[model samples]
Target: MQDNSPAQPAVDLRGVVKRFGTMTAVDHLDLTIRSGEFFTMLGASGCGKTTTLRLIAGFELPTEGQILISGQDVSDIPAYQRPVHTVFQSYALFPHLTILDNVAFPLRVRRLPRAEQRARAMAALEMVQMGRYGDRKPSQLSGGQQQRVALARALVNEPTVLLLDEPLGALDLKLRKEMQLELKDMQRRLGITFVFVTHDQEEALTLSDRIALMQGGRIVQLDTPANLYNAPQSLYAAEFIGETNLIPARMVSADHGSSVVEALGQTYRAEGTTASAGAAVTLALRPERVRREPAGTGPVGELVEIDFIGTDLRLTYRMADGSKVIVRQQNSGGIPPAIGERMPLGFETDSLRIFTS
Candidate 1:
């Protein structure tokens, strides 16, 4: 079989491992990020997402294996020589300099002609829609505006890959959402590779073309947002990517298509993987996919709490097994169930995901 990988990945890590003394910061990891792709490395704290980004940026040297950029081995290259730029969360613009000078600093360091540096800086600021504010100092701008200047500084060089280490972490919730949309738009327009490191699952889902969910210094699952959310391969993926109700079950049978599982003393069919008959498994179900009907129809639960979010109503129920089942219902203008009433909860077979425990 001819290996039909990319002709040259924008960034490739082959069995790369980085250890700080006795502790392994990055386990043996192999990854390939394609050109012009917005790839996010998402995980909890101490999961090695940032370390992997540093390895790609040549900030940290790997103890074993090789790193490649565009098919060339760059394991020995220094950070200054690498065709990559990093945007940290701190928005590290020079406080004493104007926005234009801050963005032009990179070009000036290379000894480019003064005119060219100024033109490039102005163009970069224009790209971020901060051209009119070029004369303002960093202290005069808001947090969002300062971050935009930092983005312009990173873009001025037109690097092959831009590594962002939680660049939106410092912003508030409302501004974070706005910046998420802006960053996505910017990446699509620029068409350059983006390796974003974030521990926030929603941020990864909102911004990435694909997400690499890392755990304990290794990638646990790699897929598009929809795939990772809809058809998770493992229990960890189902729990980590979103809110999931993991119900203990016993597998009755499984094939290439679906599996028959028995849960809460009820028989149900679920999407199958490698689970076989008589094996202990768990069924992953999302809240939005479930519905509540009259009592005596399905799994019975008592309505515990109801939250009136603007667009939807979130209902929490106490299941027969003492587990809480949450249901998200759109505002259809119909009166919801009484707070103390017992109701039956039902969901479709297609939404059930099975994983061996």
Candidate 2:
């Protein structure tokens, strides 16, 4: 499973697997992250994303396969010795110590000179925009500030990679978004590789240059955010990445590059290169892609409910065959249709995604 060549990856995992007794956590996972790139491992809880992050950080050893960091095999290396630092969700700062002391602790452990340690700690704090709050204890600072201190402590060591395990989870939504941008900017400025782990799809989509989506102890999909959203290879990937309406369909006919599916008592052609005729398939249509035409204008559906989601409206409808579908419309002009109203729901063939289940 070794990907041996002249081109070395910043982080590489080959045939990586972790098992707890009969339960397989991470199953034969393989991944490669380029230098100075922001990579995210995203999945639901118990999907082994956190375990994979720990394995890379040397906090846990793989039951099988190897892990390399900057071309060096560090599978057996201890967590402290690895040239990586992790920022945990729970800040893990010392409440008794001031921010400056907390950030300086790592340097102090290395026995650096007091003057040098203070200078480095201050510089790191400045990078996180927490230089002025160095005198305050963790308790005195807000959750976001404490997180900044934790980040400062991790960065003061100048590790080659920074592992963030849901570091922004404790912050409020607005603060969390602000920190996401800040963290991305900081990572770029430092030119250090970042391996972030989170279950939040929006966070991954915003921060990651590439995301490895895990499910059921395996990497189900790995791609750039755009590709993961636009062209999912599987039903699970499509449904997990965004809001998709999975309509039951059967492949009616197929050519070299396209196929027609019969769904909701209508035959619609979809653009997929490979799918067999007579195969049971599911059509993935994004909620935003569905257009509401004039009533009785095209394929008809009854709007059963409307949800006002601040900036947008979510309309739930039922097709002629009693299949439920959701459509997201921007709330620009006025209020949307009330319940029990019928509307024409139409989508282009290009916007449809066909997957064999």
Candidate 3:
């Protein structure tokens, strides 16, 4: 007879809490990263994303709770003993060592034969497209090249999981974006669980299969990139993930799927929340989701300002009630709207997200 069970998570944090002297870094957090998935812990500085990554890497023990790696509880294990490797923002390569030697350093410490070490190190370097630079010193490589070497070092050990703590943070904007694509592609090829931490929202959305948007040492929302952007559960999630136009509103009627909201002296049926009728709420509207209409087709507003941002035009309008609405439309080589021109704006009901204040 055979019994079946689901595969264990690549990393699991069960009610994990980390506290410093008079300060709580990671609150009671429970999270599970699926095997071979690109998981990102994203938040601003001091939000415990780094601390959480440290805990998973066994750099810091949890004050309370357990951490499991590949179905084994390793909450108390030392960093070197865990089946995981970390790539830090600084790269931490030895300046004196050759690129191949730097990657082989881990194997050397484990007493692996020099031949095996070199073979494994070269293979890892090839995986990151840095094999040809094996003989160069760290100082001789560009920032992006050094980053790839660091990643190669981390991968040389063939760890069950890889933890990246903003590895691309040190690169310039253009190189950072280039590395973002490389990192995602590499992760896909390796099929190793990557636990990435970053404060950059765009980077997180770009590389992560799922993201945990953390605040105050706790996860505020955990979902795929698209879901986090399109269906943010709260205002913070909305404003943090992308630009949103927040408008003051009140719930006229609340239903399961849709609700009637009154805002800018007009009524609209939009996505609903748990808020009851007569509840004061906020409407989150994405600028690109808004539609500009004929002068009197919908609520009319005076275009106060227009900005040409490369591929898009940002238009700001002041409604009759003195509320401002911003719209972003693609620049299709058409005439621009003049300032002070009154035009009606319309948006689909489902595009508006209603959240109780």
lDDT tens per residue, model 3, 85-185: 99989998999999999999999999999899999999999988998999999999998899999999999988899999999999999999999999899
Q: What is the C-alpha lDDT profile of model 1 across 124-213, one tens digit per residue?
A: 999889999989999999989999999999989999999999999999999999999999999999988899999999999999988999
Candidates' lDDT values, in order? 0.89, 0.88, 0.91
Candidate 3's error at 346, in angstroms? 0.5
Ranked by lDDT, top first: 3, 1, 2
Ranking by TM-score: 3, 1, 2
lDDT per residue for candidate 2 within 1-357, as digits (tens), equals 123433767889999999999999999998988778899999999999999999988989999999999889999999988888999999899888889999999899899999999999999999888999989889998898889999999899988889999999889999999999999998889988899999999899999988999997798989989988888878888888879998888989986557788888788888653567888888998999888888534568898888899888999999988888899989997756889988888876788878887
> What TM-score, over all chains together, does every model reach?
0.94, 0.94, 0.95
Runs off by more than 4 Å, candidate 2: 1-6, 272-275, 295-297
Winner on TM-score (2 vs 3): 3
Clashing pairs in 1: none
TM-score of candidate 3 on Cα atoms, chains taken together: 0.95
